[model samples]
Target: MSRTKKDDKPAGWRKAEIIEAAAQCFMERGYHATTVDDVATRLNATKGRIYHHYATKTDLFFDVHRTGMDRLFSAIRPVHDRGGPARERLVAMLLAHARAMLEHHTYETVVAQGVQVHRFDQTTEGQRQTMRDLIATRDTLEQLFKSTLEDAIAEGTLAARDVSIAVKVLLGGLQWSIFWYRPQPGETEADRVALAEKMVAPLVAGLRAAD
Candidate 1:
């Protein structure tokens, strides 16, 4: 017997839908304001489906945040693993990061906003375990950025400033793009690439040693 089209969806599709809906809810309403029912309502599905995949609203939100971080790291992971000139690799990583931010704008927005309102300490021990997992996932991506910056400095592509401070500035600037960057009707990825290159070029130049 042939399966129906709906039944033909890959196993992960349903979970992806739930995460997408939850991300939208968290973005539209603040994290504290959003509930599992809100996500189910947005998805036009029952809460059971979500509960099947996530134990609580916090768990769902944590998955949403993890999804965003995973997208970011997946995009940069190739450049990070590739052997290349440090400057070239750094540029590749920055461009990948910007593209990921644009593609996963909603998830990224929720993550930026939710971190301010959500606290792991409020959760039970099990829930806190989930929170720690999410934080570690986020920190891994951050360490990738830090490692890239350090490599650039070591290669003389960037100056010998504190890697921690440099990573902060780089990530802060990249994250703020989610807030203000509105693409015009005819805007292309090339346009965004050019803009990103322009924004980072001067900073990179400033980091070069005086000769």
Candidate 2:
């Protein structure tokens, strides 16, 4: 969090520096192509600096994935836990998710890549275990939707033949935006929220029970 723009990381925030720099390196060069050295170069620190925190590239990858999961859970969990009719809470969760995905683009993109990384057998066992942990956390994230969807159904506010399918479609719609959503220059946070609301309309509307 140094004021000087040359990547001068303060002492207390060194691990954060490693994570952020590693995220950028992974985003640009990919996991296989990026090394600890690459991340150190970006942070303007020695390779030893990154090593002091993360033992290996795989460790750094998991930390990036953990950060992304943290963003998602931190954003939506509060909205999910609040007392409300399920539909309202679900809408709030969707709005929160949309905002997080659009605003935290780089970190979230790394989260999105975990499925592919899991499929690749070349990574170390530790990396695969990290992915399993991430996948489990992601499943819990989906459970938020399933819980609300059940409430909405019980109240006759929404209907679905299969709630699991509904959950997948609803959350999958949000994930798709990470691929194509880019902020237009000079756009504000309000602009992004409005856009997220618009993007989520189809799925939210489709869940409504007929009049």
lDDT per residue for candidate 2 within 33-100, as digits (tens), equals 89888998998889987888878888888899899889999999999989689988888898898888
Poorest 10 consecutive residues by lDDT, candidate 1: 202-211
Which tens-of-lDDT digit does each residue in 89-122 have in candidate 1?
8777877777777667788987786566454337
Root-mean-square deviation of each candidate, in angstroms? 3.5, 3.3
lDDT of 1 at 111: 78
Off by over 4 Å in 2: 1-12, 123-125, 207-211
lDDT scores of the candidates, listed in order = 0.78, 0.84
Query: Which residue pairs come into collision in candidate 1?
Result: none
Provide the clash count, candidate 1.
0
Pairs in clash, predicted candidate 2? none
**Residue 171 displacement (Å), model 2:** 1.1
TM-score on alpha carbons, each prediction: 0.83, 0.88
